[model samples]
Every structure is written in C-alpha cells, then in structure tokens.
Target: MTVMAKPRPTGQPGYSETLPRAAESAAVARRLVRTALAAWGLEDQIDDAVVVITELVSNAVDHGRLTSIRVVVSRPTEDWVRLAVVDRSMAVPLMRTDTNDDRIRGRGLLLVDRLTERWGTDRYRWGKQVWADLRCESAR
Candidate 1:
C-alpha cells in the first residue's frame, strides 16, 4: 500500500517516505503521483507524471548509498505539479551526455529532461532533491 497526504489548500506542502534502495521505489513514486493528481482532481495528467516519477526514483537508487529513498510531491503553482526524490548520496546527478548504448544502464535524467517542462535540484539535510515539473494539462 502507498501513503496518502491530506488535502491542504494553502502554501506549498509535501509528503516524505523512506524505503530501501533495493525496494521498489518506482512503484511508490507512481502511486504518489497518482494520488497527488487525484487529490487535485487532475487524473488526466497521470501517464506523463508516472514516467517522470519512475526515472527520478531509479536515479535515486542507483546513485544513492543508503537503501532509503525519499519522495516529495508538491503543487508549486496552478500550472505545474512538482515531483522530487532524495537519497543518501552526495554525488550530484547530471543528464546523460552519452547516448543509450548497448546493455548498460543510464538515461534516467535524459528521459526526465525530455518529458518535464522544467526541472532542477536543491540540497536537503541529508542529500539533495532532483525534481521535475509536470504541466497541469495534457495539451500544455
């Protein structure tokens, strides 16, 4: 089961969760995005958000040392929904410069860059937040 945050019609607010990096953080991210969308009555933006969430969680696990992954979701504005993930690593993440070669791994941020309208990072108490903004509407 996934955790659900209560509706707060005010300033910025988010939920945080920690799970082992070995655990299925992607699925939790998916669930968080869906719940956030539904809470805002914007289920139409579901698919796009899920893809972005998956990528974010995957990166957190790959680069982070601690098995714990943290996800934060917020509505920064009426036009965008923000998704963020934190982990227990200090190394910053960068968009993949190399192309997706053979059977190796990578391209998480690359996919995020292409999908999200805007994305950035911020330092947290433990590590950092790699987050992206999803447009509120499909046509946008």
Candidate 2:
C-alpha cells in the first residue's frame, strides 16, 4: 500500500499504519488503535476495539496475500469509532455458525460480531478492507 504523508480527512479524526502481515504486528496495531481512541477521548472503547483489530489483523496475516497490511482507525462520528484492516486479499471473512468448543479455529469473527455494533468488508481494486464500528455509549 502507498503511504500517505498526511492522512486524508474523513470529517473526523483518523489514522493509519502499514505493518508486516505477521502475528507480531498485532501488537503495533493494538497500540495504533489505543492511541487513536485515547486521542479522540474514546478510551472506553479501547478494549473492544483492540480485540476487534487484533482479530482482523490475525485474519489478514493468516489469509491475505502480500507481505504487508494496513490498520486504519477513524472516528466517523462522536459515538462511533471505526477499526479496519486492509490487505491484498479478496476473501470475505465469514463468521462460522458451526463452531463448537471442540473446534480450534473459526470463532474470531464471532467474537468481533459480539463486540462491535456493526462490521463488514470493503472490496477495492487492489484488495479488501475488513472493518468494524464500535459504539461509544459515553459519547451519547
């Protein structure tokens, strides 16, 4: 992905960081999310946002093509913070309904579903971005 020296405006505060598509990159992604939320005064959403971003980054590292992925955090509204992972993959993340305790995988998106107000994928010419919106109750 091309790096932007300055972030484009989205009518609210936003930030993005490009990182290697590796497991360790999740830590950096978490810090990016936490920092953005803290700057926006949305600290209450930090824990859930971190979890959501970690899952998204994990999926990207496991399934996405290419060597790097981008993590984006944006406050589109006072009450909502958007966390997104962009990778060079067209694969849409499906939340498996057949997961059992015996199953070792396939429950990450389920956890994301439970924690976020809404989430989905945005496909672009180069790849896809999976994003989740966390609602801040205190912002209301």
Q: lDDT for each of the candidates?
A: 0.79, 0.89
Clash tally, candidates in order: 1, 0
What range of 10 consecutive residues in model 1 has the weakest lDDT sum? Answer: 7-16
Give model 1's TM-score versus the native structure. 0.82
Candidate 2 pairs with clashing backbones: none
> Which segments of candidate 1 are over 4 A away from where they belong?
1-13
**Residue-level lDDT tens digits of model 1 in 1-140:** 99898866622445457767854778877888888788777798888888988888888888888868888878877888888888777778887787847736687787789888989888767788889988888447
Q: In model 2, where do residues sit more than 4 Å from their true spots?
A: 1-12
Best by TM-score: 2
The digit string of per-residue lDDT tens for model 2 on 1-140 reads: 99778854542557899999999999999999989988877778888889999999999999999999999998787677889999999888999888656888778999999999899999999899999988887755
